[model samples]
Target: MMLLDLFAVIAAAVLSVRGAPALTQDPQAAERPTAGVFVATDLNWGGDTLWIPDASNGSCIVLPAPFYQGTSSFGPDKGIACSLWYHDDCDSRNPSFGPLRTPGVSTQADWSNATYNPNSIDNNGIAPNSWDKQVTAFNCWNVGEDGLHID
Candidate 1:
């Protein structure tokens, strides 16, 4: 996102949190921000990076570009930080429900040429292994990627 756009988002978020009359309608209907996909060049959510914004709740997003070989995060939007996993196939076993997090070792020349199937993910920042690079599918929110709730 652009700097101004990001700033606007932050400002709006602050306003919403602080109860801006126009922005605040039903207090009980408030929502939390969603942290989308974050990629790092190194392991353990470290190194140079790139990030994709959160997809809408219950929506599936297939990356059309290349972003292979790196660590990942669920972002800090939710109340509690949690561990998450990713899958390679978009089948019954690898249903598209829940966010993705992973770090992997890839030998591909670039993001496009690289295969991204991160076998495992560790959001607790304590997994012994890195993310797998052979990935095609991932986990995301069961409801939507817009709220703070985890399922």
Candidate 2:
């Protein structure tokens, strides 16, 4: 009986190990956005580079560089010092919405043109000017190769 129990345990362990790979690989199995999926930039002020994902709200998944906190036209410098200029979707109510669907690099200009720009900003340094200076997108993904997904 003890031997039979040991064999059952071993079989369970083997099955678990075999199943582990399937679970782990499931995310990759799904069609994921490739690297450099989208680009992000500031709209109101041209050349004010925006990262792909905004780390402030814990939404971004990638970025180009480690965002730095520096004083700028926006308020006190803190958090990932970049705009959340673009995303895959327009509606914030949905989790999967972002910029992937939108062709071309996501830019502040695109965000500014959106109807929902005003309510997106919290007056924080990162999203300082929702009315005048729009940053962030509804469905955008991060492109930072380093995997620095958050601020």
**Predicted candidate 2 versus true structure: per-residue lDDT over 1-151, tens digit per residue:** 9999999898889656533222121122223323222221232222333323233343443333311221111210122223333332333432221222223323445433433334543323333223232223322334343434442
For all candidates, the clash counts are 17, 20
Relative to the true structure, candidate 1 has a C-alpha RMSD (angstroms) of: 13.0
Query: How far off is residue 39 in model 2, in Å?
Result: 1.8
TM-score of 2: 0.25
lDDT of 2 at 59: 43
The C-alpha TM-scores of every prediction are: 0.35, 0.25
Model 1: per-residue lDDT, tens digit, 22-50? 31112113353554444433334433444
For candidate 2, the per-residue lDDT at 129 reads 26
| lDDT for residue 148 in candidate 1, whole number 0-100 | 54
Q: Which candidate number would show the highest lDDT if scored against the true structure?
A: 1
Q: How far off is residue 110 in model 1, in Å?
A: 24
Query: RMSD for each model, in Å, please?
Result: 13.0, 16.8
Question: What C-alpha lDDT do the candidate models reach, one value each?
Answer: 0.36, 0.31
Error of 2 at 145 (Å): 28
